[model samples]
Target chain A: MGLVGNVCVVGLGLIGGSVLRAAAGAGHSVWGTTASAADASAAAADGFDVGTDAAAALRRAAERDALVVLAVPLPSVGDVLRLVTEHAPGCRLTDVVSVKEPVAEAVRRFAPSARYVGGHPMAGTSASGWAAGSAGLFADAAWVVAAEDGGDPSVLREVTALALDCGAHVVPATAAEHDAAVARISHLPHVLAAVLAAVGADGGPLALALAAGSFGDGTRVAGSRVELVRAMCEGNRSALLDAVDDALGRLGAARGSLASTGSLGKTLEAGHAGRLALTEQRAAARTPLRIDLTAPDAMAALRALGSRGGRITALDGAVALAETT
Target chain B: MGLVGNVCVVGLGLIGGSVLRAAAGAGHSVWGTTASAADASAAAADGFDVGTDAAAALRRAAERDALVVLAVPLPSVGDVLRLVTEHAPGCRLTDVVSVKEPVAEAVRRFAPSARYVGGHPMAGTSASGWAAGSAGLFADAAWVVAAEDGGDPSVLREVTALALDCGAHVVPATAAEHDAAVARISHLPHVLAAVLAAVGADGGPLALALAAGSFGDGTRVAGSRVELVRAMCEGNRSALLDAVDDALGRLGAARGSLASTGSLGKTLEAGHAGRLALTEQRAAARTPLRIDLTAPDAMAALRALGSRGGRITALDGAVALAETT
Candidate 1:
């Protein structure tokens, strides 16, 4: 991966910290800016070249023609863009916001001199902060390299190279396309999970004790950070609302069929087929022979199985291994 | 574990097969009734005393004053109740149906002399059938033993004892309570997962590939056998509808709050709190110090960790050892 020089990363939160770490590990000099002095100290302790003055950091990086990554949340995108345009006049700009279309528009108006590519790495955990960041956080995950129609080609290339060097599969798309897709796949699911969980909570203590399997899995994202999810939903309000309406439409059909077995079964039948179609596209759907790692002494048994040859990904009640080519 | 002589298990599916195997391994004679000759032959091959004639098997068990477990699905419950009432008149009858109130009412109407206890063992996998059954399936799981007010105390005691012998924790509850709890926790989640999957499928192939983390998990139950889920939903219709409507009400509020930061953040804030409340109830909620097992060759690392002594559950990306007293 060829970079013009070093990189400038702002925000110093989980996403930005991870990007700084990954870039540094890839042998690219990274200058990080934190919103607070404590965050600056923590990042510096983590071996990052850090500062609290984002404008000064961007100016320094832009002098060397560095890529300035705005790894802040959606609410701060416009302010960050303004800072980048003022200090890093001709620098290549990229972002890690969940919603892309609004950022693209913001970039168009606020960062006129900067060549901008809106990007989002589709990987995260419930945990946040600089301490939670890892260099390998983006490994094997999708990084949407969302570009506008008239951006500098070299800037897009450099951003894509940076993402790939971080070990992400760069998905090329327009900002609108990325926004529409994430609204359906990411933002909508998070909000719905929260709703499902709130509903379960309303059922009282007995319902909580009995919650497992589908309930546990369905509401998994309800525990995500409120500020992050709220930003995602509010930023992409139209698309998120559209996705929710689509889901509620399907749910309404299922509800309508409640009184009739034939109709209810038909809804389930469609659902089953739809699930199969969607899941079959993913590589994880391949039925790896289950390694019975369910014993209480499961770790010992897994060792015995692994000695024979298998690649285990997730182990709960059982171990599932993807067959190596 | 004291039993009333031996046990008779009807229907040789995953649940029944597991029960039969477990009861037999615990030194009890288990006579099983299968719906088909192939099923009977398969059970016999597994060292079970199996037959295709349901009435004959029930009569034999009743004559010997045995505990007769009806481990069939919901649709077969009424027919099985008729058979037990006719042939196994005074037997202590219990069932493993997902719903309970209907069974309790059916027992009152159809099998007056047969002492009935409604039971549901809360354990399963994506797999089904006798081939997928294990003697330890019910181990460390909840087995709800629901008995009506007028049932003989001895019958409830025997049923609870059998659940214990099969390595389950017996949860004493009324049929209506069991049904309502299950509707919120189990049935409603399955239907909602299906709806979510169907909506994603409507988003087309791009959305499918982009679906990861919560999306994959939230829709995991969509792959469940359709008839089983349909039966679950239809059998507990009113309760399931109540749960769905409750979820919709929460979702509607979230929808209305899309424009305001205060309201949107409040929805997510409530969701975060709800998820914590629901998950904190489980013993698994305690954050045991994580033993990193992300290395492909992780078992060796686990063996070293195991030597330190604690309860080791399953190992995947990490070996989580809960601290012991």
Candidate 2:
């Protein structure tokens, strides 16, 4: 209900398309833009006011007090930023890019006048294009929001509200922390799938025919497009590489101790415990309260909320909240 | 329809319970034996004739012209084989163990007089125990069967017939071939999941909370009980270690190529192609014809069955068949 203005989503990819569908259904005035004329026309056919010119769309959206979302690939963020600065100087900007630090850096360098926030919704189906997206794509998914240094608080609030409007659970994080975390969880796993499948290629026809369940599930993400893999790996290069090293080190230790059944069993038992923790984390839910507070008043706000069982989560530099039972 | 008379399923674990359910539904008088008294009682509660004494069950089943399936853990295969030889002498025996070569070796060493055929039903749910099984668990799943050296041809045919009666896609493979194939597809994925989860243990709360569909699915098998993991790794030690080396080599190559965008993209692309091939393999199916032909008559069998567009699949060295479109 806090998101009162018009919305502009500047890509017709899966994430952008899903946001458009959800925002429009939530009664926000939604506008969409894509590089392809066919996609723009398709969006128009679907009853959204869509175009291929992102800047022009953002400019018109700015006049209506819109939140302009940059949903293109990572490399295109700088270009989208430049266009927004040139055409829609004072508008609020956010993005759906997977990696955040680089986008935040770009926002600081190119879009000085615009209010900018970097965001990523950890949600997608196997399919990529707009046709594969639906209004339910972001429902119950973790959506991270990262504010650029000295960015407007109102802009971050509006972006978080937009994520909430799409039925996502907002998880506020610094750009640096987000990049590092995803490098471990998302990026590394994609590479792991590729590694698993690469090995499976040597297995011949029998292996291919017998690979069911876990094999299919484990290697599912290796089927991701090259562009996406490139963007994710190159975008979070150091962290991704570090995570890979951590994995190989663990596996190497297991390999060294493989002949020792006791050691191998211990390592596997630890993994079972780790998987249990992951399952528990996914199942746990918290009711969140978005409250305005300065650093001095944050503890007081948290204390007023509860001390028995809850966590303090920062929304931005100036606001904090409680995630509670 | 080829499976006649009584059936006995030893162990009453996931595979054994499912076999009992399916065989009983297929109009066979089924008996079940489990090491755990609770499991035997539970199977009996499910309307099955069940007991804790596996040897007694097999001995009784042997007198009734039964097809006896050993569905115990991998290490117990040799002991189960010995029991079959001692108590159920000359009975038709098969197993649902994951590893085949070891089971075949055990049959030769301990159950030389028992008519033994090694089998593995490529079907299971995440849950174990008799409580988690259904009558339709093996429906349309790959069921690999391997014959012991100098085993009766009639025994192999009867086991394959039982697999078909359980609504499985019968895929006959040698013990050596089956062990190698499963080491790559099934066993390796389990260890891969374990390795991935081991690395994930080093990641903090943020990474775990944000992990969604792919991470969960990729590591699902890591949650398997440690006993099973130990049994699998130990029983198929050599092939599993080889698969691990192959995967490590592939991942090391990717890590080495991380600095080269072109190389990284190509590796990911190959993985994509591999995954597509796997998907196609899973989706592709055909009805098969069991054609009896000697080694000398193989070419004639192939010629007569040919050009009609089907694959030639060997059946236990004594016969060959066509898996037709």
- Top candidate (DockQ): 2
DockQ for each candidate?
0.24, 0.43
lDDT of 2 by residue, B169-286 (tens): 6565667777887888888888878877867756766677677776787788898887777777768887888887887787777777775552467567767877877876656777
Which pairs of residues have clashing backbones in candidate 1? none
**Top candidate (lDDT):** 2
Candidate 2 has a TM-score of 0.87
Q: What would the DockQ be for model 2?
A: 0.43
Q: Which stretch of 10 consecutive residues in model 1 chain B shows the poorest summed lDDT?
A: B306-315
Q: Which stretches of candidate 2 lie over 4 Å from their true place?
A: A1-3, A27-32, A61-65, A129-132, A147-151, A285-290, A293-325, B1-3, B29-32, B45-47, B58-66, B147-149, B260-263, B285-288, B293-325
Error of 2 at A2 (Å): 3.2
- Residue-level lDDT tens digits of model 1 in A1-325: 3632488998888888899999888888889998878878999987779989988999897788788898887778889888887888788888888888888888878888787877888888888778888999989787776544455555655676678678775555567766777777788788778877877776655566556688899888988888778777788987877877777777777777785543478678777887897656664433454444333543343333322222233322233332211
User: Candidate 2, residue B199: CA error in Å?
Assistant: 3.0
